[model samples]
Target: MKLADKHTPTKEVKYGKALGGFVVAVNISMLLCLVTENLFSYGAAFVSLVGTLALFFDVMITLQFILLVLEIWSRFSRLNAALQDALYPHCTELFVGASPSYRCSLLQLQKTYVALGRAADHLMSHFGLPMAFDIAFCICGATCSSYEVLVKLLSDSDVPGLSIGMPVSISEVWLALHWLRILLLSLSCAAVEDTAAATGVILIRASVVPQRRTAEFDEFLRFTLHGPRTSFSAAGFVKIDRRLIVSALTVVVTYLIILGQLTFK
Candidate 1:
């Protein structure tokens, strides 16, 4: 692919719509959480309603992703076509204005488009759609751990002088951690903003001027958002925060092992 163009009309409109839809989905999800706040008080009736609604929201999230895939696919095709066209006649002088890999940068972004496309496809299947489940499971575990810690803190045998237990409820801890988890998830929107910014810059560049020199530089900037793959190796993982995942795993494993031993013993 040529890897050098600043604007894509189809891509811009499609992704713009995807971003809007995702915003709506997130708002709806938050609303569901708010509505269920009083559910625990109602006991089984509340539980039944909340559980069914949760499943429905999960399905809706899946649909949001399907739309996302379509949006990305439309952009990727436009990019591929544009780049392939650009690569031929100007092959020799193409990236000469900038560094060679500067030209390769567009190719790299194309690769990212392909990678995300595949990931989206896998997400539509049975096994790959569990990212939401992972989010849910982590929230559940964190809530339970917080509640257990709160209980132990209040018990005289475990920690003296903290026995104001009557006022505390398990749901309070659950709600607090649930809110925090969602707040953290919102940070990922920062990534979307970066994507939007890059899309805007490139599209403007492509539409107004398709000149070789500036286009190369624009392509270079576009590829900055696509980090390298193969994150297991030393240099490969440098940009990624592997420690966060490692620490999370350590906590979950230690908690599970201790809980199991204490239960059986």
Candidate 2:
């Protein structure tokens, strides 16, 4: 599909707008609370306000990453649908001399698959740098957030004081949200990768139908089998999949443990 045709941008746009609005409102409300508390006690809420602002940006980036995943998922779904239609054409006839309509449908499917691939590539290129930044941000955020939660639970004194004007529970909730975002991002990447791989399998299956084994079929099979496959990576270091979640958790836990040791010392 052409760029214009690819981006319907109705539902996704609305979702992004809604998320941005909500984040802004939350940040503003927290800032107001912090200001009120600071007025009562000079310099008491400064650290908490700064931490809240950092969290606001972190959450905003996470939400934007989620939106990118949604867009990628939608594109992959469209590609899969086109592949399915190509595999099983509407015409009931299965003989070598299929109807002209079937031929046209197959041609259209080929064009669609190519267009979809280009669109996916464009999206990846556009989001590549941002994704790298997000990965780094998430790793650091996860480490700090996890360590803070651990300290809160173990220490008698609340030295960090992350929740100055807000309830103490909010700090725990924020950490949970950070972890949840990481998990969802990993799952979304895996889903998109699987969907693209499924198209390749479907093409291979379609190519093997004994009733439809022709030179053209062989050529299309060869083309598809040799084409570029879809995959996702994080900052060029690790692939994004279910395994990534486990790996990220491991890193977070290791950091938390190291921090705990230092704190005790």
Candidate 3:
């Protein structure tokens, strides 16, 4: 099947765009707050303002890339759904005859799956580095921000400027946002992995059906099983799945603990 034949659902595209836009807007607001607070301080911190602006632009670019990644995953999922529908149509007897047309449909679905996997691989090749950077930045940002807040609380320092409250400071908010973004990214990648794996399972189940059991069906099944497995990884280092979020959180906590120790000393 041609690449143009597959189409992403309009609703999914719209939702992804809207969510990305909202995240970017919130991040911009946070960065603007930081900049404004710094500007109005005792001494004009032009250096800090430059850093804040750099962060602002960096976040904007990262969010835009994330939006693209999400759209690609969304389209992959939609293609997988279409493949599933092809394998199992509304009528139970759709594949009962095991005709040549049914076999062709299966082949087409397999081709589509391969195309989707290639698209995923292409995306990983191009965006994997940036995504790894995003994850590292989030982990470091969350850890450092949390550490600063903890140090402030422990020292009983004057809560001046943006660091006003004890429970909900600007740093805490920044940490929360970083963590949220990490969680969302992990979940989205895991979802794509799960969907692709499910496609294989569905094919296997379809091939085992008594009515659908045929040489052609078995051939298609073997072809699918032998093909490259679909998964999302970060710069070929680690696979992104549900466990990723937990592992990332563990790293963040460990770094925070180390930072705490160093600060206390």
Better of 2 and 3 by TM-score: 3
RMSD of 1: 13.7
lDDT of 2: 0.61
Structural similarity to truth (TM-score) of each candidate: 0.33, 0.70, 0.77
Off by over 4 Å in 3: 1-49, 157-168, 214-216
lDDT of 1 by residue, 112-179 (tens): 55454345344335323354553555546564555465555546465444444323444454445444
Per-candidate clashes, comma-separated: 6, 0, 0
Clashing pairs in 1: 2-83, 6-202, 6-203, 6-206, 7-203, 7-206
Model 2 lDDT tens row, 1-265: 3542343222243354564465456545644554454445445577767766766676666566656665566655665665566557623445656456545555554555566666556666666676667666667777886776666665546545323333334455555555666676788778767876776677687765666554555655665678876667654667777897888788888988898888777
Cα error of candidate 1 at position 135, Å: 2.7
lDDT scores in order: 0.46, 0.61, 0.68
lDDT of 3 by residue, 164-205 (tens): 343436676677768767876777677667777777677677
